[model samples]
Target: MNYEDLFIQYQNLEKSLKDKTKLLAKLEKAISKEMEGGDISRCITDTAVMKSVSAEVTSLLQEIESLVSSFDGKEYIESGDFVSQMLEQCAENGVDVTGSSPNFEMFPNKVRIDVENQDIYLDRKKVACLRPVVLVQAIKKGQEKLLKASFNANKFASELIVAYDLALADLGKNPGTDLYLQKLYNYMVPMSRFRKDYDLQSYAFDLARLYAVGSSVEIKDGRKIQWGTSRDGKKGIRILDGNGREEFLATIRLF
Candidate 1:
């Protein structure tokens, strides 16, 4: 090779070495930070809807789980439309059953209880559309339990407002159907993780995996731990406790 060619080759080699060195340094720094215990990593955006949705789903799932644990699915049907009956009882007792819903397919039969303003639609009518009458009956029993519980009623009402609005938004836009699906799936996906005690980011990933809603998370130091979401502007989700550990507010996404 010519002397000039040799020098050019040497220069290229040098550049490659420098690039490799830089990447190595970055990897080392990341490893060091990881070893030293960096702040909790958040995997999602800090949106009010996201947080609210997560909370709602987790709470509902928890209720369903509790019911499942108690009944094992066999007792309710044997008892005959227990949930629907209970809902009727609530109506007779004059309790508000507005917006309380049951996953319809989970039941083998469907029992319709007349509620003011909104008819209780099960999972079959709502999403999966598998209207099993028995399962529907079980769902009625479950929903009746929910309606009777003051705590469940409050949470269900709040979720109903959000769900209805989101569903309406979905129904309105034809071209934006994908966006609506993303939003709905985003809310539904994180629910299982939240129910299982995973933090917001983990739940967010679940949404991404199921619904393909992608997002980035960032954290900064402040007087209080704060969370922000894509939909809302600069809303805080955390506060620094006296002990300095960040406490979550309405939402939490790790650093």
Candidate 2:
């Protein structure tokens, strides 16, 4: 059977299993209430609905176990060869691949395949299994997530208002032409490296991409949020784009 097809089947079965388990729980609860009527001889076989639901739950569990056993898969250890293989396989399957060596990323959505660590990560949550089919599943999931992860310029601009407001408050709440963009960035994002949080880094990366793509930020309050360049001796947030060059955004003004 096709691995992807089998995986999809397995997922569907798992979902069905959950539904059956819930029905089984309801049956058990109902039985407990019935038993409270003082019938000592009553058991799980006492009613047709109770017996039917319990039997279905048992059959589902067995089928799931059998399906799992049929997947004769093994761990895919990371090596130089594994990286090359993934580069080809992932792209062939329509997931864009980038980065290099032990650490690389793929996406129609953001997923990190850490070859050295034998893991796949989305939003810093690790997929622990090193099974090759699991990687395929991850690629498919990345594609699905792409549909949901589109950049929302309006939401981002709204957050900018919050960050800008906090920066203004920090600087004594006086009327100013602009808030230093670096100050706003510091308020809005955490120092990921020091905090040991990859989610914060991911968030900062998304923000930097906005600058790279020249995305517009607008406030709904009839105010304008504008990006300004930093001149000599002015502090700025350097958006380092992995190719050895950087971009800067120094000031933001709301009027």
Candidate 3:
């Protein structure tokens, strides 16, 4: 089946499962009531109905799983035309996107879509479905429901300074030592607690914002961390945003 047909089938199967589940719930209550009222035949009938409906639900779930798992990479993930079509569909739906290959971000919410992995990340957590409309829905939900709270530069800088210091101390490195960008993310973002959801992707956005829009804190006498780019074929942290020219950040100098 084509992607559209597959998506529709998944939705229909889910609806059927939900209906069957509701019938099973009613049957459970009926069976209990009939048994308590000493209606043996009625209880037996309801129990049988419940068992049959439950079996149907199980079968539907297995079918759904099979349908989702059966798609080959050539049909979607590895197909050049499929990727293009997916992005085109999003643009037609009025979802502006950036970076046409390997990854794409649905703007103005920065919802990252990794086509290679077939994963959609909203805020730092993964969204569950491979549904094609997810690209549009992600932007809509970000605009309507998951609106972000204001980013606090002072709060983040304060926490980040501590994290940087702790990272240095833990590594047995001296003050003002250059730290790896990945090291900071692995060390700091996970160690500190924040009022809002601040995962690694959150770290990416926060750091990008700080670098692009200037932070409120000066770590030591106006000294702060500086990001360095890899020049000798070393891998760097890829910033997955569509708006900017800077793609990878490799090193950081902490003050």
Evaluated at residue 222, the lDDT of candidate 1 is 16
Per-residue lDDT over 160-196 for candidate 1, one digit per residue giving the tens place of the 0 to 100 score? 2344346546567432222322334344434655543
Worst 10 residues of 1 by lDDT: 210-219
My TM-score estimates for the predictions, one after another, are 0.17, 0.43, 0.50
- lDDT (tens digit, per residue) of candidate 3 on 1-255: 257777788899999999999898899888888988999998888888888888999999999999878865445755664566667677677665666555565533455556657675665457755555665666656644422557666667767778778898888989888777777776664645652456655566666655554545555456676677664324565553335554556777765
Clashes of each: 22, 0, 0
Local accuracy of candidate 2 as per-residue lDDT tens digits, 1-255: 244555787888889888877877876777787789766456445566767877887888888789877764323334344455556667566555556754554432345666555566664668665444457567668555644578776787778778787777777766545877655766776464644443433444555655544535555786765677654324754444434244455777776
What number of backbone clashes does candidate 2 have, counting pairs of residues 3 or more apart or in separate chains? Answer: 0
On TM-score, the leading prediction is 3
List where candidate 3 sits over 4 angstroms from the true fold: 1-82, 90-134, 137-148, 189-198, 215-221, 231-234, 240-243
Full-model lDDT for every candidate: 0.37, 0.61, 0.66
Residue 128 Cα positional deviation in candidate 3, in Å, after optimal superposition: 6.3
Model 3 — which ten-residue stretch has the worst lDDT?
A: 233-242
Score candidate 2 by TM-score against the native.
0.43
TM-score of the candidate numbered 1?
A: 0.17
